[model samples]
Target: MYGGADGAVAVLSVAEEQKHLLAYAPLVKRIVRQLNSQVAGAIDRDDMEQIGLMGLLEALRRYGEPDAAFGSFASLRVRGAILDELRRQDWRPRAVRQESHRLRDSVRALTRKLGREPAEKEIIAALGITAEAYQEYQLAENAEQIGSFDELLQEGMGQADSAPSPEEQLMVRRSLEQALRGLDEREQRVVQMYYEFELSYKEIAAVLDLTDARVCQLNKGALGKMKATLQSA
Candidate 1:
C-alpha cells in the first residue's frame, strides 16, 4: 500500500511502485490476452504484455481519485498504450493503406451522392472495378484495417495527460452509437457480431450465411462509414 499523503504528487518509493506493479500484474495479463487474440502475427503477445505493464505503471503514477473506478481508468490507459505502440510499429504496406483510403473516399462519395449507405455493387461501380477486382481490393483493405477497435475506443479519450471525464466518455459512447445507427441493418449486425461478440470472420460468415470474403468487405465498409460519421459528428 502507498503511504503517501492523499492526492499529493510525489515520487513513489521503489517498493511502492513494485507493490502496485505486482497488484496489477493480473490486469496486465488479462488485457494482453484479449488483445493478443485480435492481433495475431502482427505483434508478439510478450511485447504487448510489456507495453501493458508500462501503461499500468503510467496509470499508477498519474491516477487521481475520480468517480470512475481505478481499474476502469487503468484499463483504458493500458489499452491505449498498447494501441499507441501498435500504431507506431504499423507494418501495413503503403500501397495497401493508399488503396484502403481510396476505398473509404469512394464509399463516402457514393453515400453522399445516393443520400444513403451505398450498396456493395454501387461501391464497386463507383470505383469502376470488376467484381473480382473489388473483392481483391476489399480483402487487401480488410487485412490492412483489421483490429481497428482500438482507435474506435480511443476516439474521444483525448491525451493521456487529460483522460476523458465521465461526461466526455458518455458523450463519446453516444456518438459511437449514433455513428453505428448510420450503418444499414446488415452492417450493424456484422459490426456487433464481430466486435462486440468477438467472432472471427469465418464464424460471422457462417452465422450471416455470407462468404468469408463478403463478411470482410462488409466489416471494412461498415467501419469506414462509422469512422466518417464519427468524424463529422
Candidate 2:
C-alpha cells in the first residue's frame, strides 16, 4: 500500500522507491516517444510524458510484487493513458466518424479496382470529388484517426520507426493466425479479408453475405479472442 505524502517514510523505503522510479524512467520516456509518433503530432512528447507519468504512478500503485513483470503492466497502462488523453481531446468530428465507414469503403474499392496503391487523385476520382474538395475532406475528416490503411501500412509496405520489430511482428502474425485457425472458416476469411486485405467492414459483409452489424460482431468477437490468447501466451 502507498503511504500518504505526510507520513514519515523510512529512508530505506524512500531509497527503494527512488530506485524503482530510476529504473522505469527510461521505459516511460520511450513509451511517451512511441505514443507521440503514433499520434502524428496531434500531441507532443512532453504531453505524452506527463500522461505516461500518471500511468507509471497507477502501475506502481497496483503492482503486486517486485518479480511480477512491472514493465509489461506499465506498458499497457501508459498506452491506455495516452489513448484516454486522445479520447478526451475529441480530435475527430462526429460527422467525420459517422462518414468514416463510407470513406473507408470508397478507399477499399478504389484500391481493389486499381490493383495497386491508389494515388490520392485516384481516391478522389473514385469518390467523385474535385481535388481541392478531396484535400479539404482529408484534412477535416481523417487527420488523426487510427487503424487506416495508409497509417497502418506506412509508406510502401515498410514499417515506421514507431512500428513493432520483426520478431514482434512475426509473433503478432502467428498469434493472429492461430486465433483465426480456431474460428469457423467463414469467420476467419471474413476477418482476413477485412483486416489483412484492408477491405472495409461493408465490403466484408457484402462478400460474406451477412449484415454489417453481424460482420461487426463476428470481427469484434474474433479479435477479442485473439487478444486474450496472445496476452495469455
Q: For this target, which candidate reaches the highest lDDT against the unseen true structure?
A: 1
Q: What local lDDT score does residue 124 receive in model 1, on the 0 to 100 scale?
A: 79
Per-residue lDDT tens digits for candidate 1, residues 4-24, read 435354566768878878888
TM-score of each: 0.59, 0.46
RMSD of 2: 13.5
Count of clashes, each model: 0, 0
Top candidate (TM-score): 1
lDDT of 2 by residue, 1-233 (tens): 31335432223355665677677878778655544533457777787888877776665555422333446546656666776788789755687666765776787788888888687667877888776655445543423433332222232223332223345446655765676677787778866775445455557778989655455556655655655665565
Model 1: residues >4 Å from true position, as ranges?
1-40, 64-76, 93-140, 146-149, 197-203, 206-212
Model 2 global lDDT (CA atoms, 0 to 1): 0.58
Model 2: runs farther than 4 Å from truth? 1-14, 93-102, 105-125, 128-177, 180-233
